[model samples]
Target chain A: MTPKVFYISDGTAITAEIFGHAVLSQFPIEFEALTIPFIDAIEKAEKVKQQINDCFITTQVRPIVFHSIVNAEIRDIIFASEALDYDFLNTFVSPLEQQLGVKAQPVINRTHGKAKESYENRIDAINYTLDNDDGQTMKNMDKADIILLGVSRCGKTPSSLYLSMQFGIKAANYPFTEDDMDNLKLPSELKKNKSKLFGLTIDPQRLHEIRQSRLENSRYSSLRQCRIEVKEVEMLFKKEKIPFVNATNHSVEEIAAKILDKTGLKRHMF
Target chain B: MTPKVFYISDGTAITAEIFGHAVLSQFPIEFEALTIPFIDAIEKAEKVKQQINDCFITTQVRPIVFHSIVNAEIRDIIFASEALDYDFLNTFVSPLEQQLGVKAQPVINRTHGKAKESYENRIDAINYTLDNDDGQTMKNMDKADIILLGVSRCGKTPSSLYLSMQFGIKAANYPFTEDDMDNLKLPSELKKNKSKLFGLTIDPQRLHEIRQSRLENSRYSSLRQCRIEVKEVEMLFKKEKIPFVNATNHSVEEIAAKILDKTGLKRHMF
Candidate 1:
């Protein structure tokens, strides 16, 4: 069954969605989620309440609301809505106030505010990923926190960008061309940075499917080529004593987490 | 005062960190956080317990633990640790199980699993952003979900990438160069798709600081140039009837959300 889930927040509502998804994933039910952002005023809150009530009346089911709304006046209107509300900010703030002996400061979207250093770091990391993508420029290799090495379509690009976007990691990804895989040797430019290299391997069949989707019926997407490339790349990683992960069944988030977990690389922002 | 925060998870610990940051932002207390990931095994759980105990001993106060660990045994161990734990997964899972009339699946790191279609969409969006960045490929303008327009360093690149990375929205960003700002006309390439255009403006002083960090003491980084470019871009946006947002003090997440809200663009996922 598809349950209606509303993620309401004074700002982005990303945090509510993250926690909501984590909790809701335990159940086998599917969710149709909606985000209501920038609801800092009472009028917006009243509109949201009307929407929630209308959804319940139309569907004959109370929608689930996951919110991080911090304004007490606005939050009161949402709390009065017809939904199973889970507002983490309000639920936890009061106890924290008593424990810390200080009143909670209800700033609208303060988490992403004033943290300019980390904000700039994330932006710089993304720019770095864009610039160093596919080994386009080796000039800034030294600036990379981690270098992802893999054959084409082995999930390097997405994983590299995910690392940068989520953790402020300067990730530079280089594709292992057919020539390098045939040589069974790390490229000279990457040889000096062996310690920074992390490899990614994938199932040949899966690789073929991904490649075929991009380049229909080409030799590059052929099963035989995929098998050979996967074998050689795995061999190369093993021969070079570089740690690697199989990305056939893993999401980009999972692959990135594994890389960071294994590498223990210090992030630009922690 | 600085209180220690621990984001522990059986997987990436990212969800814990995201929610932890959101909830903790309500309080004025400062936090020093450490992420302990991959604690699915009993031994790893024991190690985490010891670390938590050691941290408590060292700090003379209990740490605030935000976790998403699913394994019951491992969670039991963490629960036994000397910390004020907030395991939202378990806290909300039982109620969901009861409501759904099914036992909750206690899989480790399952939120990002088996969602291959959304994963592929995100990757494709990132690739699209890279290809169309800075008006590099106007050939594929029709495929863009949203086109970002702004003066240089108005945060088009990072905002575009964030939209792609998080929501799988194909975003193409173009910079308003000095010549284009002078003309105050939309580029011919973008004229046909004015409806998809969203503009970004920034504070001149902040823009000066950001540009000076990269290209120091240049006309591009000059305060006067920044002011003129911002004024021209705002005028252009108004004249064209294109929606815009000031990105001077906002984070990439905030800017992306505002864009999505303003555009009413349907995400490739959700």
Candidate 2:
């Protein structure tokens, strides 16, 4: 039987989930997972404890609970349950407090809350990314912290959004379509902001498969077309001395990280 | 002086950052953090170790290092540094291995790397959300996992994008504009998909401030107009018996989590 794992927290539980998921993924076997967030009240904690106990009764095994609960009262209730608890927050907090010689303030929602200025910057980055997406307008290119240049299906949009969302960076992406394949050169707007340019390329076969799914049997989705477009775009990137990464084997997370790493971009953590 | 901290990983280090940030946020003081990702090589690890040692020598304070490095050799190199290391991954892995009666098969990039099916689902959801954003067309409302209803600039777009980007939920948002305030009613498509409808309401004053920043002194950004639109849309929500939440003081993460909790939408972890 697959083991049962629960990620519980008083806040969004996103941190708990990420922490547990990372640890669990190292194991070879699969485990069933559930997330229960916003467990601020004693009543809610009791109910969750019951759910864990009931799962233990049914499965004949103790469920694994990973929690970052801040409230001592509610956390104690969870500790008293039949589940094997991994107290993520308190585990690190005690040691840190000792090292720093200061007691932890332990405010709920501090990790993901809107810290006024950073929150505004993040929202602005999102809006900026949206407005400048898909070569929509070059008028605002000068305002962008980074401009992504890539073919339509080579993973530009998702990477741009991830950069802006994960880090408070103003990202704008522009596509290099088939129309620009013949005499591919940087537009005047993109040339002026050449230092901000980052390129993404994909394996032609992968590009063909992606485009075929979107537009089957069309010339745009043809293998020949994909190969030609990728070649031209890559040559342009080389000629312009622009840094680029292959998106075929990497996720958006990896791509975004690689871009920031190559460019030495400061990641503004929220 | 602000204590220096590092989030290091062999992969994207996103998990390390999230774990470190969550733990550090519990403290009342600010930290100076630097993230070094893709640290897969021994030379890279040695250089990072040197940097940590250099910082200790300069400040006479050991920097706090949080690493999720999978490779034992590379991890040990960092372990030899003068910094106070918080090894996030291995801390729980040993206990988990004993509990599960299985050895961990540690693979790099497992946490955020593209797991084929989940990655495809996420990308598809992102495309669906973008194509259907702002009620561009209600034709696809039938296909959405959730439909967000709110006035313009009341946090619809960012919330919808977050739901799709983070949780892989196809979130479609529709705006109730100034014109809709005179006779606010659900579109036929929304009425048919009422079960998937979720509402977001913001404080009129906050709404006024958000809109004013976008379009200065316009009737649309007027405080009275903001009040009228919010009141009418909220009434529509009540009359339709649609569930709603106040986005006034909440971040997008909070709003998204609340929506998932209220709707019981299964969060597809990427």
Candidate 3:
């Protein structure tokens, strides 16, 4: 039986799904998530109990996620965390409450967690954008104001997916395949759309770390191969006039900002 | 001199990009969004001041988002409408927040009057999933253990995208094209993948309101077409024994829950 997680949010299922998916990703264990939204205090607690029972009935020991922007009283009813009463939305929402059709309340007890969100969900967008895609996305290359090109471990997929999912901008990235690297030129299709092109490069060491799990210890997965690929791709980006960024030692946040800054194209895509 | 919106998030530029793009879609209004991340007391204010000098900053009308865990004195120095002195992470993050490392703060003084975010942003994943996508994303199907099929405005897109984006599931949705509708059969792709199929349908009147903006007063845009398309497609779903839900007034929360209830397909990609 899979573990059970529940998302209890006020407004939409997206909030729950957003939290649910993220929590599940951090652990290797199998889990099942159920979302209960537009739920109030009474229903939220009841659902948690019910879901827990349901999971126990099925999976025996239910591992779970309860994600929400809920209130103190409600949080206490469901989870035993001391930070349940602590919340963050009160200040920003004061003005928009009337328009959003919700009331406001003040509750304090929680402090800022040591770190901020890493947006691991965007990785979902990345995988989907790469795996679920066909020729149609690549067809609109000219309309894309920014295009990312790089090898598999260069971080092109995550960056491009973030741009499209977050900004609504039609962004597309093409891989710098071995064929392109050997030929020492961008794909003819990408070369034609060179004005919007950008590239990403990473330290060969880090590149190997990212690829090792998937490829195993083959020659193609060697440090020497990574180094060679990095250099070839760098040369290719330069020859094609594609500005490139080195992602070693930089956090994803820092890397994305540098990329946004270098593109000089407006970064305003919702 | 585009209006400059500032994002003080700590994650990727994608956070700013999404917010920026969302704000941009409401244009005749032109604005450049300047993003500053990993902000604390001093630098946060500086970014706001710099933007004020360089561009017509909207929230400088005092925009701020912080948690209660931070000092109140800092809130005075920086402009946060809905400041959280508390932590945004709750053992887990919503995919959107986890990826971006930012959370929505309340707008205190709506004096500047930014429209509330559209239903689009909150559940953007769902919409992305339902976007017919013209078969651009076929390869990622393994990630999509569940795919949604429905007519226009049936809430299929938002639900599917939400599942995919939030869960890292490769979710795909196909609009039962006119050809499929006429034949009273599931599309060949879906028919071949029957075990993974899920369906969604919505009230015709609801569908009419949703489509009104894009089609305006055209005949195809009429309530009549909406009703017919809905009725015919629903019958088609029934004929093929496709499981579906009628997405009338239910919020995204309810819709997603109902889907989970009906399909029994798990969406956590990991």
Candidate 4:
């Protein structure tokens, strides 16, 4: 049986998950992971402890817990539970306290608490992305922090959304059609905004596989079409001297970060 | 002058930023933070070192650096810079390596690498959120993990989007109008799906300010109107014994986490 992994936090459990996943990645064994966020009260912690102990009895395997509980009482209860509990925040907080010469006050979800301007900026970015998805709002190109250029399924949409959601960047994406791909020239509107354009290219084989999954036996999903489109896109990007990244192997997060890094676009709001 | 803070990473620089901001929040000093992500090569490392040095020269204050560079060469360069560099990855990697009895692989953005299914699931959730935004797709209410019920500008939309974007939760939001607010009774459509409903209430003054920023001097933006609507929504929630949150002080991330914790609805994907 795969080992049970739980991410517990007094807040979002996002940090706990991030730290837990990173640490767990060193091991090859698989795990069934669950997230328990906003365990702010001792009563909730007690319930979680019961669940952890119950898992121990059922699986005869101690559950691995990665937690960022701010309350000492709750943390102690979880620590005493029949599980391998790692207190992510406390472990790092002490070292940080020593280095910064200040005690780390345990505030639940303090990082996420009402940075009103940042939150509003991110929401505005998300709205902008939604309004600009797939060249729907080409007239608003000037509003974008970066415009992603790619063929269909080259991952413009998800990358744009990720950039918006995570970093509050107003990302607009335009898909290059067969007509644009055949010409090997940038669209007139995009050419004027060349400085803000970032290209995404994928291997023909990978594109074929991805497209085929969505539409079986279609010409657009064919290996030949995929090859032609990918080659044209890469050539256009190179000819235009536009910086680009390969989306064949990377996740949306990686793609977004690379785009931001390459373009030197400020995240707009933290 | 505000002390400079740099987040350096060979990958997304997300971990660096998250950890750095958390630690820096303890200090009252203002910082002009910059994110330098995907500095994988020696040449880039040298460039970053120069920037760090320049910051020191310009500000006459040692910059605080939070880094998660996996490349030893890149790490060494930043480490040698005149900055208080906190190596986030290596600081914890060794302890985790010892615990797991395995060497931690220094893979840049490994945590963000393709978990294809999870990626697709998140995309689907995002699409769901967009399609269901503002109660436009009421037919799909049954598919939602949580349905946020609130008066206008009470933070239903952003919270729903945040839940979907971050946790892959299918969150749909419905707005209660004057008609619904007038009666303390739940709308018949919502009554059937009461189990999925989560209410969001905002302080009337905060709501007034938010709406005023959007539309000036309108009935919707009036303090009296905001007060009445908020009061009615809270009364409705109380009468129905519906679980709700005050979105007055918390960011969208905090609100989403609290919703997830209260509902016990598992995030559709990791």
Model-by-model lDDT, in order? 0.85, 0.92, 0.51, 0.82
Q: What is the lDDT for A73 in model 3?
A: 61
TM-score of 1: 0.96
User: Which digits, one per residue and each the tens of the lDDT, describe model 2 over residues B173-268?
Assistant: 999888887788999999999999999999999999999999999999999999999999999999999999999988888899899989999877
Residue pairs with backbone overlap in model 2? none
TM-score of model 2, chain A?
Answer: 0.98
**Ranking by TM-score, best first?**
2, 1, 4, 3
Task: Using TM-score as the measure, name the better of candidate 2 and candidate 4.
Answer: 2
Distance from true location, Cα of A22 in model 3, Å: 9.2
Whichever of 1 and 3 has more DockQ, that candidate is 1
TM-scores for candidates 1 onward, in order: 0.96, 0.99, 0.57, 0.87
Candidate 1: residue B200 Cα off by (Å): 1.1
**Candidate 3 lDDT, tens digit per residue, B1-270?**
333345543333233333223222323333344555434456655665455444434433323232211223434444333321112233123443433344523222111111223111212333345443434556544445677777765666545554554443445776755455555666566777877777788887767776785578876568888877888888877888888888775543356566766676554432
Query: What's the CA RMSD of model 4 in angstroms?
Result: 3.4
Per residue, candidate 3 scores C-alpha lDDT tens digits across A202-262 of: 9988778667855889766788888888889888877767898896655333555667766
List ranges where model 4 is wrong by over 4 Å.
Answer: A46-63, A72-85, A95-106, A178-192, A212-228, B46-62, B72-77, B80-82, B101-103, B178-194, B235-242
Model 1: per-residue lDDT, tens digit, A170-213? 99999887776557787677887889999999999999999999
lDDT for each residue of candidate 1 in B91-169, tens digit (9 for 90 to 100): 7777666665778867667776447788789889988998899887788888888999998988999889888878889
**lDDT measured at residue A245 in model 2 versus the true structure, 0 to 100:** 97
lDDT of 2 at B180: 83
